[model samples]
Target: MKLEHVSKTIRHKVLFDDISFQIHKGLYRLTGKNGSGKSTLIRLLSGLSAFDNEKRLKLEGDVLFLDLNPIGLAPFSIKDNFYLLCKTYQVKLTPELEANVEAFFSDSYNDDYLHASVGTKLKLGLSLLLVKEWDYIFIDETLSTIDNDSLKIVAKQLVKLSKTSTIIYVFHNLSCLLLEQNSRILHIEGGKVREV
Candidate 1:
């Protein structure tokens, strides 16, 4: 996917101005200071929010965006939530998906939705979404809530998955996981985006 001549403005303050960038199929790490428009750029690139683009965004494939918010129905069983997500995205419950979820939830963790922590909920949501074949997967600070072990596991899994899907992991402060994954860096600052 390519974002050409992209710009965003809110409340009379310019967030980004006429920035052009291309998103390829690989792992990417997005970094910036607080309120630097990292999420805004993701929203624009992933078609979550409108851009002051004049229709300049050219998306090449279906995008799956997972932010800090745990995806799925809040008032449902874990199984039911997974099922609903799969149905919404038109994906099957493949073994890869099962493995992905298992990486986060051990054989011992409670399967109940209410009992699951934010990390577990996000993990389940991510696993269900990641199973699908998407052109780009933009994860914005969702993994930060997970415990260290699970984060490491998910990071490794994300690295593996990046070979097939374009994964964009965003953070306010850069993490070592990105370096370990050898992810390309996209930094947002001064109302501009640049590859570093």
Candidate 2:
């Protein structure tokens, strides 16, 4: 994907301006201070928000964006949520996909996703997202609330997924997960983006 001269304005305040970059398949870390437009940038990249100059944006392949809270359909069971998401995405839930979801949650299939533990919910959401094919995946501080064990599982899955998908993750701190080798880190500050 390539973004040229991208800019965003919120409530008459400029968040970023003329930001441009080309991203390839790999792991990327986006870090910056609170209110520094990290989430805004992710939104723009994922097409959740429109850029000032849409013509300057060049995207390739399918894109998936997972926000800080990815636990969808809280009142429903994991099975139900999975079904709903797959339905929304127009994905056919085959037997193999069902088995994968069951394996992801293990014994939590019967429990309400909203009531599940934080780690369990995170694991379930991450596992569910992995079922679909995505060329670019943007996660905005979603894994920060998971436990160490669950974090490890999610990290391993992300590493595996990175082989075929471009992952752009926004983290407030780098100590949360051990990043993969050669992962690029970009810093956003003062409405400017610079590789750090």
Clashes of each: 0, 0
Candidate lDDT (C-alpha), each: 0.74, 0.75
lDDT of 1 at 26: 84
lDDT of 2 by residue, 161-191 (tens): 7889988998665554456454688889889
lDDT of 1 by residue, 111-153 (tens): 7777777777887656654466777788888877766776777
Off by over 4 Å in 2: 53-60, 90-97, 180-182
Measure candidate 1: CA RMSD.
2.5
Model 1 stretches with alpha carbons more than 4 Å out? 54-58, 95-100, 107-110, 173-179
